[model samples]
Target: MTRPVVATIAALFKRGHVLLVRRANPPDAGRWGFPGGKVDLGESLEDAAVRELAEETGIQATAKQVFTAVDAFDHDESGVLRHHYVLVAVLCSWVSGKPLAGDDALEARWFPIEQLGSADLALSLDVEKVAKLGAQIHSNRAFELGF
Candidate 1:
């Protein structure tokens, strides 16, 4: 793509666990990560994150605030950039619904926060760091106070 596309990710946390989806598309196929996708025209960032979460994992969540932003640069074997996405990570609280793979996701489930970054799981590069930080942020009292 000529210009970097904007995307949003939901770092939804609940009861010490975080929701994840195994992506079924290129760029990071079969890798576990937060549910997200491109922000629709005129849609707010948090709204896009929540919408993607529900669409990809059948999970409903309340977007708290933006957690972080990261770049996903896809490169060909020849080291040429193919696609780049500016991903805004949103911290969210689990509201309802169980994760069921939909949209461009192959599988969906909740994983213990402690399992993040485990060698056994094939996660997108930033999943572990984002999740750990998100969980900590969600647990803080300020999270509930909406500060």
Candidate 2:
């Protein structure tokens, strides 16, 4: 079986809040995660990230830089190697338009930085780590520029 290459974009909003979406489909239905989807044909990773973010959440953003990459593989109960993804997460700041849940996302909300570690958060460890890294980058930039 051929493995899937997926690219994901995570939006880190102001006030240390990250956007989390509830998936509307299977593989991880009803679970909360960063707003993103699979990369489309002939699309660059950065473009894919921008597209997925707009599709999953009604927010437009520019993918500034890649903050993290994660390789994940999983099998089903039937021992089928069902899911695999090379998730490329990019750091993005909101550019235009207020966000609303859209496409594969059942819902969307701003999750505070502290809330990420709570048991209620269903995202993977890598997701949280990348978000923290993004936040750190933002913080550093702010400090340097005296924002």
Candidate 3:
């Protein structure tokens, strides 16, 4: 039987903004979302998140924690499940590099938290909510550590 694919989405927060990528492939093509993809067979979630962030956005980041998980189910018009993904959201701290769209992304850049669900931008399902939570979590952590 087929199983839900496990993916890792990096919530790499930097300077009060979060990194996002405009997807170049389907499931959610053309929608802006956190950088991520299917996890490799032998890869850990943290590693996959960091790797995907780099692959899609050319941004180096360190995965600090697993913040949350989201279930994404794509159904065809006939109501058949086409894709089911368990997306693990990882909180990451920026290490280096600038946003350069690559891999499965058409564009990569940072968006301020306020702009996440703006009317002008097309965002993947639940992306804005997840991104906002990530920003909040990271901000809380930073404040706790006196950063």
Candidate 4:
């Protein structure tokens, strides 16, 4: 039986910038993405998000809200589904520590929202979409808060 993998993504933002990590694992290795990973058994999605973010970016943060869930599927040469993931993206605010590459991240850096689509960044489609949406949502939230 095939089961969909459950994962979480931390869309961490601070001072008009978002955190991005270059993946070090297969399925999209060396591609820029948010810091996140599969949700561990018996762990809450929010907790997993926090843990993954810290593990990948070395920055402690908490999920303030879940923004969206994205369906990601990888296909094999025969057109069969190799992997499917339901990734829940959570908007988080940085709590402490500096950004450092860890776990499945080859590198971690912060980029301004406008630069997310820059040619030099080489972001994946999904990453770009999520980053843009996350930035918009965060901006709206800040506006609501009168910040």
Candidate 5:
């Protein structure tokens, strides 16, 4: 069995918009998603998030609160033994630099909260659900707990 470990960062900007990247590889090729990637050896989660964000979107961000954690399970087309992933999603704020697509990203852009449902998001169901919750928390909307 092969277990794929991945980490993703949800960069929320403009108070109500979230950053999304169009993937260049499979598992969701050409679909939109948050900026992130696999955690490299000898790197902290925060550092990995920042590094992945910069590598994929050309944006420097500071990792804030840990928004969510998700575990996903699936099988490949060849019926190979594939284990699930424990994805750590962190909330990030823009530090500097403009976004430019790179690495596994075909494009990068910000999408409004209201448009999330209509966007061609390619993340897992668990990720998408957590992202929506994170967005609400960042938005400071009618939700309780004060984010």
Candidate 6:
């Protein structure tokens, strides 16, 4: 029996920049995206996001809220779906430490969110859209709380 894979992604934003990592694994190898990985058994979504972020990038972060979720599917040449993942994007704030590529990441760096459209970034899946949405959500929350 095939089951949908659950994964988590962290959108770490600070000063108009978002932390991105180049994936070192398959299904989007070498593409830039958030630092995240599969949700371990008996782990909460937020916990998974935090753990994945720390595992992939040496940056310590605290997950605030879920920004969005996306469905990613890979198909074989015969149109058979090989893999599917339900990726939950969590908006997080940096708590401490600097980014260093580790685990499933090839490289890690911060990208200006405002320049996403014109930037020469090879983003994976719906990363650009998720980052934009996360920015909007963060902005709205800050405004609502008068921060």
Q: Write the per-residue lDDT of candidate 6 for residues 18-116, one digit (tens) a residue.
A: 899999987788989889888989999899999999999998988899868999887877989989999999998789988899998999998889777
lDDT of 4 by residue, 35-129 (tens): 88899999988999999999998999888899888887878879889999899999997889898999999999998988977888877558878
Candidate 5 has its poorest 10 consecutive residues by lDDT at 138-147
Q: Choose 5 or 6, whichever is better by lDDT.
A: 6
Looking at model 2, which ten-residue stretch has the lowest summed lDDT?
5-14
Candidate 3 Cα outliers beyond 4 Å, as residue runs: none
Q: Please list the residue runs of candidate 2 whose C-alpha ends up more than 4 Å from where it truly belongs after superposition.
A: none
Q: Whole-model lDDT, candidate 3?
A: 0.92
Candidate 6, which ten residues in sequence have the lowest lDDT sum?
114-123
Give me the displacement of residue 65 in model 2, in angstroms: 0.3
Candidate 3 per-residue lDDT over residues 1-147, each given as its tens digit = 889999999998888888899999977889899999899999999999999999999988899999899998888889899999999999999989999999999999889989986899899998989988998999999999998
**What TM value does model 1 have?**
0.93
**lDDT for model 6:** 0.88
* Model 2 / residue 16 / CA error / Å: 1.1
lDDT per residue (tens digit) for residues 1-147 in model 2: 585768666655667788888888755778777877677888877888888888888788887777778776656878787778878887777887666888988888888877887886787546677777778887786678786
Per-residue lDDT for 88 in model 4? 95
Q: What is the lDDT of residue 94 in candidate 4?
A: 83
Of the candidates shown, which would achieve the greatest TM-score relative to the real structure?
3
Top candidate, metric lDDT: 3
> What is the TM-score (0 to 1) of candidate 6?
0.92
